[model samples]
Target: MLDQISRGAVGVLVVEDDAVTRKTLCLAIESAPELKLLTAFDSVKPALAWLETTRPDVLLTDLGLPDGSGIEIIHACTHRYPQTDIMVVTMSSDEANVLACIEAGASGYVLKDAGKMDIARAVLDLRAGGAPMSPTIARMVLAKVRDGKKPQAATFPTAGDTTSLTKREAAILDLIAQGDSYGEVAKLLSVSVGTVQTHIKNIYGKLAVHSRGEAVFEAHRRGLLKLGHPRSE
Candidate 1:
């Protein structure tokens, strides 16, 4: 399964100005079963140069680099390798950083303060097309939306295609749209409780909605799923 992933065999890139962090990030990525360490760079100059050539599956970048900001890397990634997922693993949990990264097409924003396992899970989630954001960062981003501010224009791909979901995720949504609980969906999908949570995360992003009900409504609006489909008990 890992080998079948695009550029998955080679693994992700780590870009941070801090030497210790660069090494730690590489080691952490290597620790994951599916993630192979590619190259660890300390600045945008080299990171961009390498990305122009060998596009990795995921990128762990810090917001502040000696040569440029991590946002520069995000722009470069989207412009060059749109398929590659960018995760900002940094110390800044500020709302501005959270909003800037997402607006620039960042796939996820994880705080360095999160657990090490959270970092590994985040990378895996990114590789599997999931948006893994830190709760703190998630709150910051949501706070802005709750305040009713329009998001700045960003260049995210139009997910009009139906391939945005896996078979299991789609199945789970079919149940969710009909009012299934996380535990019930997990049982139906034959996956663990945590797996169900991850599927819901992907569902929310794909549908551009925050909750199960919103996703169901959005999916109907997009004509991807029928509004009143019967769900099994």
Candidate 2:
């Protein structure tokens, strides 16, 4: 399967323990001509082994494997191949595991019940630098940020310290924390998508965060966002 991957295609690696689910994921990946099924593994061991030598453009992994948690695979890929976009395709949606996966460097999260087309679209979205999360997962993530326990003294900036975000940047962060996609944020802000992306890049730099979940968490931690309330233009 590795050798069969077409040149210049988006290589995809899937890790799922269930035979039926794994096959379904493979079929979904194969259905996209722009995507290539580099390989699929049923456990973390082979997936990690393959990852040591080869890095796929996208990784779609389930949280629970027969041998261990898939978060290990996510960590490994994120640490070793920062270019690879890691995604969680699992039935588990509990806050703990979901937060762990996001912290471990998963840019996308999708439930197993999502249709094949949704899954395919997620892959394409990730390749396009979007953080794609299922609607339920997105709400869970937002709730977690809103209700997060107060940070330790040293873990966050001091209360008197400013976040150094411009009004536009702060507004953008507010919309993002509200679970608005890039396109939606752009439309809401009356800006081009590329302009929204540039603002997000600046936001990440200022907050020292790399992913949407982290940015939201950091923004909430810094008290820069008023949860459940829309920002004025």
Candidate 3:
């Protein structure tokens, strides 16, 4: 895995259909000194073609492409180039599409309305092992967990093993499922934000999940935490 910060300039590939939106994203990426604009495409077909020979550090793509759904490209990059951080940059804030992209291996999701700078920062954040999500999208994910939607079965180690979460980690997961942000969780737990991030990283590893939504879902599925119940402080 590439250490995002250690790398001088990360290569970025963008796939969007709208001319204006695509241009806006390209310029935003160009403005970041740590990011390199590898290429931009208007459709999934050409994006897939480019992926066949080249691998980028980050992928910013729209979910609704003229040729086909950008989910295809997301899946392609994720499976083919496991190291690439894939993010969905689109207007779709609907739960279904958001969940679909998450399950398809997108590490981040950003709405086009987030403006160019937010989009650019999302890529950088993703490279830094952060799951950048629009506020609305983050709320949708928390709601999904609260609704008790069945999550995919755990593919990682089961509870009671060495890989199982420590009690503190489980508590952190409960807070996160309750829709607490990282900073909030840190304050509530009386720890630093960096400590919360470390626990979350371990939680993601044990849950075999890529995003916060998936982690919560998998935690629920594995009986790690009860849905709609936040742990008492």
Candidate 4:
């Protein structure tokens, strides 16, 4: 069965082993007007079973599950429902696990200690083509790239040697890399938020990255962008 999701709400399927944590996640999704809880499961078995027929817009899953790893779910959803965005909400801070999840098609990773609002916001951000990662997770990802521990292929495209981005798109990328919100970037460029989002979408297409984090990471890796300093307008 499916949820009674609202018209414009993002349908979320939650998979957390801990009963309390699962409840908390469901509550968080329910609290957000833009989010709808499609279903909550505590194990890989039933979650995978449900996934066979239902595709959620977002999958917020714990890495460790009773029946299997959440990576399995990520792969399944990625292959079966390519449109679905996956996020890992777990206690694991291990380097291997972090990289594994990203490789397996998870777009966002947050520690379980993150608050309800942050989790909900991360879901929205993920849906909006932004990769919402915990600060520690973000650091680990960049560190992996900096250390030359690059995987043969990323879930999203990495920057090519001759990646081409228009000046405005590059400027928007730089601003976003500097932690500017969409509205902030819009104001800085004297454009509407929709325009900023359009430029960002084009940036994603050129960079072949799905989320903001991946875009910034790939750009920095290829020296296409300077993270903290936006180019002078």
Candidate 5:
């Protein structure tokens, strides 16, 4: 464990039941100069206890644990410290499990097989306000929404729930649903990045979501997104 805490590095808390995997994740965080490994745990109990005392800037947790599910930890983190970004690293690619974690407030989802470097970069990206998901995970999430699997009632709006978005907000959401980043949306809309962010904040409020994935999923569920057609005005 490289325990040298960088002065301004992003603090990361890791939770993985597998010993080897836990070490790998810890190493990945330590390898990046921009990230600091606050601590790593093998199960949910210790991780939850640690979270009670300290809040890390980023959370990397595995879904399955011997003591309890990682979703519990995610819930606690989101509820207590909504600013802390969370990522999931697990072997399971099941859509339902993935959705459950996202609903629990995870913004990033990556399989355990992803390279250590990729995982490290993902943490940085999450800290930088990007939703970093594995390619397969991203595809699966989109496919689920496309196949009309209605999202469950949680923090986000449910099916047939009318979320009134302004024309500008709807336009921005459509562009984002088509995979545009904040910068890209700003450029296309001839606005500042801050403006795009403000609209997204309002969109999140309207959709009752805290993350980009949740907002997009809720928007799609309510038929507010026009995927391929971005605003021409």
Candidate 6:
């Protein structure tokens, strides 16, 4: 495991076209000794290209960019470095963009109108493994949750309704549902190949299934995976 930096020295890539906002964001990040402002850009293209090289551990970006939507940045960064967390620091309160950013794998979302302290707090939260959203933004997320519009609730079965899966077997089922290879699952579950094979065999017996494809399909039917998640991507 990566040692948790008590006061993590952050390498941040800021993406914003507005000069004032961009500078203000950079200054806020620079004010913290633990936070190092690696770079800032006015567009998505150059920022993303730099990310391929520098690979900043944290990214703060505005949704409205001259080159492309911030969602593109989220996709590019997370694809290249899954450990690097992403946050949206934008003026747009449009629910569409917010939801899109989340779908693209943004870990935190905050508004640009936040005060300097608020902005710094957000960066601290990102470095500390917390998602800090503006009050309005937080409310919006909660509203979405209460409305039951998010995929999380409907995507998986509740514990009370889960079928007879041993804890280890259930863990394997989760990996399979995530489209992981059996070998990857074995390594992740930290068991030998034969042990993994036996777990899968037990899973089949309990579920009355045979074949990998059949097992995955049944897992989907039971709502253990999202409806449209690629079963074998």
Best by TM-score: 5
- Write down the lDDT that model 1 would get: 0.69
What's each prediction's TM-score? 0.62, 0.78, 0.71, 0.73, 0.84, 0.62
Higher-scoring candidate on lDDT, 5 or 6: 5
Clashes of each: 0, 0, 0, 0, 0, 0
Give the better candidate number (2 or 6) by lDDT: 2
Candidate 6 achieves a global lDDT of 0.69
Instruction: Flag clash pairs in model 3.
Output: none
Q: What's the lDDT for all of these models? A: 0.69, 0.82, 0.78, 0.79, 0.82, 0.69
Sort by TM-score, best first: what order?
5, 2, 4, 3, 6, 1
Per-residue CA lDDT of model 1 for 113-149, tens digit only, reads: 7866456677776655455777776666545543432
For model 3, residues 43-162, the per-residue Cα lDDT tens digits are 989999999999999999999888899999988887688668888888988888998998777867888776544666777767765678888887777676656544433444356644
Model 2 TM-score, 2 decimals: 0.78
Q: How many Å off is the CA of 39 in candidate 1?
A: 0.7
Candidate 4 versus the native: TM-score? 0.73
Q: Model 2: clashing residue pairs?
A: none
Off by over 4 Å in 5: 1-8, 114-117, 149-162
lDDT of 6 at 47: 83
Residue 220 in candidate 3, Cα distance off native in Å: 2.7
Clashing pairs in 6: none
How accurate locally is residue 95 in candidate 2, as Cα lDDT from 0 to 100? 86
Candidate 2 ranges with C-alpha deviation above 4 Å: 1-9, 113-117, 129-131, 149-155, 159-163, 228-233
lDDT of 4: 0.79
Pairs with backbone N, CA or C atoms under 3 Å apart (clashes), candidate 1: none
**Candidate 6 lDDT tens digits, 1-233:** 12332356777889989999889889887777667788899998998889788778788999888878888888888778765768888888898787677656575788877655456667766654455677787677546534543454466556676576566776776665443556777777677867877887787666655433335445544645433232231
User: Comparing 2 and 4 by TM-score, which wins?
Assistant: 2
